[model samples]
Target chain A: MASTKTEGARRKAGRRKKEDKASTADLLLDATSELMVERNSAEVTFADIAEHSGLNPALIRYHFGSKAGLFMALLERDAGGTFHNLETLVAADMPADQKLRHHVFGVIKTYWRYPYMNRLVAALSLESDSEAARFIAERFTRTLSEAQRRILEQGEREGLFRKIDPTLFYFSVIGSCDHLFTARHSLKFAFGVEEIDDDLRIRYSDHVASILLDSVMV
Target chain B: MASTKTEGARRKAGRRKKEDKASTADLLLDATSELMVERNSAEVTFADIAEHSGLNPALIRYHFGSKAGLFMALLERDAGGTFHNLETLVAADMPADQKLRHHVFGVIKTYWRYPYMNRLVAALSLESDSEAARFIAERFTRTLSEAQRRILEQGEREGLFRKIDPTLFYFSVIGSCDHLFTARHSLKFAFGVEEIDDDLRIRYSDHVASILLDSVMV
Candidate 1:
């Protein structure tokens, strides 16, 4: 009976340790995400992250094994959330037009919520030779292609979308929306606007959706 | 006769020195443009640029006065070229449709020729709070807005384009094309492509033109 009680206590202790590690990892990533928004990723250091997270610098090394490892972890965390959201949207039972609109708007909304994501991605995209960068490139492509394939298939079945290359269509839609925000400085200056408010975002989103629907559909 | 020859010699010496300085400045800017393509501006340093340009490190300081000054010179040089091309296209007495198509193709070809320009602009877009960044941002925006205003005026006069917000339309069209290359890695992954080739670029240019024409035309 005493042995049984000790085993139960040990199991609870193990669960607590797991929870602690998870929380610490979350804290580290949260700090990294915040910092990345303010500055370029190349400008960030492990010590900066530790100071921001209020965790020991050594803990980062212990948990992630290195600075690059920590960056990859942050990317994985954000990408996983983004992918999950994408999967849920794609899995819904809706008309292809509605699905496409939702998917595009949803992505724009997600990206806006995390403005640093595009910069982080832009940085990695250029550094394609790195392992972490390659992972991001590959994973994002696979995820997007799968979602695009499904959307295109649905549109084709409904005879709504034209029979052009789905990949090209997808790229156009994404490029239109993503560039507006990533190039915010240039866009704002060119248009004499200060910020991308809610109304403008809605209009921009509608414009992108129209471009995609009008070009792809009959 | 002696006074005339002495004056002529002095004039020649001054011209030689001025030409030397101009050539050295050109060399630094040229090297900077190349370095900026492979790495972000923040990663570039005087030493790297000197090594690439085969000029003394002090030459950059001597010619441009500072790193930021050198960057500005590069920006002015490239922006001047791009703006010149755009102006030439706009000044032509072509119809709205043809003018728009030529302008779109011109921008795409320019981007492809100086791929690093996009990277530099993207970086500037993010770091626009800085003086140097803002200079580039302002020039780019002013150039784009002027082109857009000309296009809109032409479209209105020709009764070809629908009455739409010129700024929003400009942003959408430019965003669509620019983002594709800027986010080339993500697009490549999503489409399972190797690299953006000539055929893909041509298709993209054509498709963007079609979408813009369809959306804006009566």
Candidate 2:
């Protein structure tokens, strides 16, 4: 009976250990996301994360093995879904213009909702020499290329857009949207605006859509 | 003539002092520009500037008076002719489309030449309470608004563009170009490209111009 009880105890202990790990991982990710917005990736430390997440510094080492690992995990969690969602959204059966609109809106929504993710990505791209940057770059490029291909193909079929290289078109559209928000402070300070309101966003979005459609469409 | 010799010596010393100040100021600006690319504005220090610029640390303090002053001087020097040139290029008696094309190309050239300026502006914008950030924001807004007004007046006069709000159009064009380069690292990483080449840039400029013209033109 003692042996059986001991076995049951061991199993229960194992289950609790797994639960503890899962919770710690979740806490670390949440903390990283919060800190990233206020600070650059290079400046972040395990100590700050421990203090914020309420996890021991050793726990980071024990679980993720290092700060870089923790960072990678955070990125994996955030970007994995975003990239997948974008591909699905792009590939869905819809009109080319509608697909383009949805794709742009989806990206804006993702950036708005998880601003920390954008900051982290931006910081990593700027500072990191690791595979993370390469991974992200590859993902962005492939996605953009695919999106351009689809837009061009659709535009050709509908006889709407000019026969311009889709790559240039893609870059222009995406570039405009990213810069507006990234350079928000400059724009606001220069223009004297308080915030980029919904009305303004819509107006901006429609303007882009019109410009792009008008240029490409026959 | 002991008095005459003394006077000559004093004047020579004064000329040397002015030369020293000018050279020191230029060094600080150059150092700041280089460091701004590798490090965020917050991470930069007086020591780093001094070491990088090969000037005395005290000289930076003496000339610029503070880090902010040095940064402002750097921006002023870098962006000196960019805005003025753009205004001149766009304000000429050309068709609205040609003006838009010239403006787009001019911006691309400026950004390509002074890539660090984009980052510096971006970093400033993220600073919530920074006076520098406020200044940049206000200036950019005013610039964009002015551009919008010019485009609208020109387009309307030429009977080329629709009666849409010029501010919205201005935002769209700016957004497309700025985002393309600012988020370039991510885009390049995602796509597996090195640099956006000249051909691509021209295509992008044309595409942006086409879109804007198409949206506005009758």
Candidate 3:
């Protein structure tokens, strides 16, 4: 066991560190995100995180306590960043439609960065009484829904958008983008693509933005 | 151990059987489908399957070989029914838009009846090398995509539809409906709905059908 740990330590030592100088917690979160995308949340393990990040298992325990803790931290980081972007866009001087388009693109880009975030959010929020679920509802879902409502109202006032249910319409917009990355593998298979390259991601955002705006634009 | 097995056997035998009198294999598949919906695919277990169906573990092993096998059988059965419905609609003498509407409703109903089908399909197809993955690709994904293509072409040819990419349009239609059911719990929490009742299901089908047709109907 001592020799095995030493060998593991030596191999980890041989690896180059991240150039951006991400914190240990952030590195662990990124590793968890990658594993979730590959094998999903349920299949991922703490050992997988330790191995994937080449960090000490004790360090992971010290930072996050558990895999669930790490996953929630990841969600808080990504979803909070996305909400911040939406707030910035909403505060911008752009028109309602453009703001809405940018909002949708922002969401797609977030999911693009963390492909498994939607699946994780859905799983965590469903039948869960944890802080993660509450954070998602308050910081992510409700905040985004309210932002969309403001956009919809502004568009209607400006006579640039049709009257639509903000809840349902936002769900449609989100489902459209969320399903793309959440179901990326299947969609790729259905569309006969070997991978979701950058071009396809842009095309998908364009497609979803067009569909959402077309449905409500005057 | 002998006494425990006897107790289990007695309980299993005392449990009332289904009126329709399904075979053990059919019972196993139905039980698995129920569990997948209730708990999603990642959380199900062979013990859970045996407990839910009141069948012996040996019987499950004997019939389906493994839990994954039972899941594939359920997918095949459900996807096959959906395809059958689509084929029937396509062969009907109805107009292209009507056929497309029916197809959309058919998908919504399928997800309603088997709420976890989309999640299961995505999970299974992501990194699976099993026959379940292949069955989903050939029977579920390909069949549905092909049907959508035919409907799109027919609608355009009949002068009732605008030109659209069938792949992306189909993704939106499916994403709209599939998201509602797959993330029913989260959406329920977000929207403050206690449940998605029949009225909501009808409203959903109508909403999806309207959204899809509105995008394409000329």
Candidate 4:
């Protein structure tokens, strides 16, 4: 009985250790996100992140392996579920138009919730090494584009959506979805929109989905 | 005859002096543009600009007043004509749909020619003082949005366009127009598109115009 209790204790200890590691990583990521959003930039450094997280900078290097790895991990943490949900939506039994509209809303809301995401993706893809860039493209861009392609194809098959190049559609739709969030200064200065509250986000989402649906619908 | 010759020589000297000043300023602007394009950033220092232009750094301060002034000047040089032409286009006798399609093409082409233009505008607006940001919005963002509002209103009145918010349209259209250029690395990594040639630009232009026109048309 003592031997069995010892084994159980060891397993419990192992699980507790793993949970501690995961929580520490999450704390680092949360700090990174906060710093990036507060600064409105993806150029936040390890020192900044360390100070913000109140953790040793060495912990970051240990957890993420490198800055590129940390960024990639952050992308995965923030957007992994989003991309996964997109695939599920694509596979679901909904009509093409409905799926596309939902996809549009999801993209906008994702940006709304994490204003630094698309910018982070762009920065990583632009400045990181080729391997990191490729990983990002494969994990994020390609997945989104592929899901879009499937939806476009499905819509065409359903005789609902007009034939459009999925590649071009990817750029346009993604661009339109994220613009309001990205161009916050333009909103403030040009339109006197000082804040992007939930109401504004919904309104903008409806506007984008409306126009895009109109463009693609028969 | 001697008095006439003296006056002529003095005038000639004055003209030469003015032309020399103008050319030196132009040289500085040209060097700034070249370095920005080469580095894909607007963070180029005054020292870098001076070294590239082979002009004393003091000349930049003297000619433009400050870095913000220099950026503002660059915007005027690059986009001033585009905005002026947009005003002309709005007042033209063309049909609303045709005008909007042309505007879409114009926007895409502008970003293509000056890939750094929008990014520079965003950076200036985000990082600079309120005065500079306000100036940029007044000079560029408001002008673009107002032209779009006029076009949209014209389209609605002419029974050619569905009602849409001009502000939302501004974000969507500009976002769509500039995405391909800004997401260059995404294109390279995701689509294996290493270069954005005229062919791609023309094709993308047609695609954006078609969808946007379709969305807005009654």
Candidate 5:
């Protein structure tokens, strides 16, 4: 997991010497995510990645194996940070309230930067039989769900929060945060804004955090 | 919108002679929805609809203009119920508390039965420039958003509920309801449950209601 993150991060840092830092598979993956986020995943191809990242076309297959493999790698890289951080927070013997609050920030903050991750998870998840989705579940969603469940149970026991249905609680927190990112186009239509402004980004994140804190606190 | 619902219902009711009910456009739409729900929308095609519904392939184009048209019809049909119901409740000159409570039920209950509807909305909503997505924005999303904003404003002014960012509030409501259905695979993998039972369904709806009520009630 760390390897993927470092690899992706290093590839990103190679912005100065794009050609000098050769064979960084992460650029191809970045190209894939960039295209998918701007457009749709189904329409993305290796050629598109080459065009965007200035990588040789052969490097796409040489690095990531296949199309699904490319995205699976990206999902893994990001999940390592979000889910792994959540795991750490949950495991920490900190105040349950603080842990839960910080957890909300971590989840929402990740989506704020990488809105398309939600779409990827939803897509892979719909295919239950797929190895990639199963891997994500084993590595990410279920792991985070368990951690959240533990925090909720502890918080309730400590009288810091109400007894929550953990599954719904997780979804409520996530859904609220993700809605702005996932529903950007729809929100644009509703608010008549061409794009979300920087002020709204701060407002949206704060709005989401307070909503969760107020809803869950006893 | 009401016309589409009545038309679909009347067609469904003519079920006695299933085969004799030839060229029922609703069946074609149902077949398409059924396939899309089971799998992904991109993979579903006209032949699959014909295979699933036992209808003539030619009848597909005859009834709906194209594949996207067929899904758009289904989306419109479902939106009619959810959006129209919200409009009616928002317009009703009743106590804001009662109206808002009923509104939550309308939102969650519709999603309870039609989980794929969430996926369809997300997919179409992301494609802002598409005619289908734009039509959805005008017909369903914008209209419902205005109604939700009105209810929130009225409730807060009356001191019946706390002030909330109406867009975030609406997203929170939909996200909580939509998560269990959309993330069924990851949920299944987490808890090792093969399918969501009736109990979880009831618990989920109640859980969602209480979350909203608790968060908003002053």
Candidate 6:
């Protein structure tokens, strides 16, 4: 009983050390995300992030190879859950319509949380000849396209949705999901909506899902 | 008769001189537009514009007052037709469905030609406390929202379309229209589409129009 207790205590101590090391990186990432959301832009500098997190600036380069590397990590951290949830939803044993509604809501919710994500993705992807860009393209962009293709195919097999080109549909659906967040100025200036609260987010999600679902329904 | 001929010749000379002065500004704007499309970005500089147009950099400032002024002028030159066309279409006696399709096609075509307009508009409007930003918010953004409102109202009045929030519809429809051009990198990486050719543009227009029309149909 003494030996067993000793081993359990040692494992707990090791886990604590591991988590402590990981938390620094997590803290930096959280700082960057908060700055991005607060500024509604991806133009935050290393100094800003360092000051925000109260960490040494050198630690950023040590943890992430560069600014782009840091942004890439932020993207992964912010989007990891979204991609996983999407895969599970695509494979879930539910009707296509229900799955689609959930997927639409999921996308809007992701954007709502990380309104700077789409801009970050676009900038990273547009960096010519960067390995980070290629990784994002294949990992994030391709994954999204493939998931969409599968959902459309499954929906067709179930006779719930008519045929539509997945490529065009990608532009249409993702575009619809992204615009409200991207054009916040327009929202405020044109409609007097100064903020995207939970209520507006829910209504926007329903609006997009209903329109797009009707667009593809048989 | 001799005096009349002289007067006519003098008037012709004046007209030629006026055209010569105006064409320089037009040439600079055209060069800027060409550079934007070629680069698929709105980051063109005045030196680049001068180099492309073979005109002095001072001419740009002289004509446009500043870089922002130049971009504002470009937006006006490119989008003036679209706004007028929209107003005319909204006031036309055609059924709402037809009008919607035509509007969709018109918007897609405009983005196709000036793919940088959306980015330009976003930047200008995001410039806080700037008179130009306010002008864009009122002249361009508000104009679009008003036109959409009129269309939806007409559609409901004709009993040909179901009721939907114009504000949400603005996000959905405009977002759908702008995404294809804005996410060109996604097109290449995700779907192997390198360019937005006329064939692709037409087909995309039809897809958006048909799906959107179905969504709003009574």
In the order shown, the candidates' DockQ scores are 0.54, 0.60, 0.35, 0.70, 0.45, 0.63
The residue pairs that clash in candidate 4, if any, are none
Candidate 3, residues A35-68: lDDT per residue as tens digits?
A: 8877744357788888999988787778877655
Residue A55 displacement (Å), model 1? 2.0
- lDDT of candidate 3 over B94-175, digit per residue (tens): 8899998888788888988888888777757754565666677677877887888888888888999888887777667778
lDDT score for residue A45 of model 3: 70
Using TM-score as the measure, the top candidate is: 4
Off by more than 4 A, model 2: A1-16, A38-43, A61-68, A116-118, A191-201, B1-9, B37-44, B126-129, B164-171, B186-192, B196-200
TM-score of each: 0.89, 0.84, 0.86, 0.93, 0.82, 0.89
- TM-score, candidate 1, is 0.89
List the candidate numbers ranked by DockQ, top first.
Answer: 4, 6, 2, 1, 5, 3
Report the lDDT of model 1 for residue A177: 69
RMSD value for candidate 1:
2.9
- Over A1-218, each residue of candidate 5 has an lDDT whose tens digit, in order, gives 99999998888878656654443776776777788778733346678889998988888787767666776778887766577577678889898888877877677777766777777776666543477777767876777778888998888888888877777776666677677777777776666666666677667767666766676788
lDDT of 3: 0.76
User: How far out, in Å, is residue B73 in model 1?
Assistant: 1.9
CA deviation > 4 Å runs, candidate 4 = A1-17, B1-14
Better of 5 and 6 by DockQ: 6
Stretches of candidate 5 exceeding 4 Å from the true structure: A1-23, A40-43, A54-58, A91-94, A126-130, B1-23, B40-43, B56-58, B92-94, B126-130
Two-way TM-score contest, 1 vs 2, winner: 1
Ranking by TM-score: 4, 6, 1, 3, 2, 5
Pairs with steric clashes in candidate 6: none
Proportion of native contacts in model 2?
Answer: 0.79
Candidate 6 C-alpha error for residue A129, in Å: 2.9
Name the weakest run of 10 consecutive residues (lDDT summed) in model 2 chain B: B36-45
lDDT of each: 0.73, 0.68, 0.76, 0.87, 0.73, 0.87
> Which 10 residues in a row give candidate 6 chain B its minimum summed lDDT?
B123-132
Model 6's CAPRI class?
medium
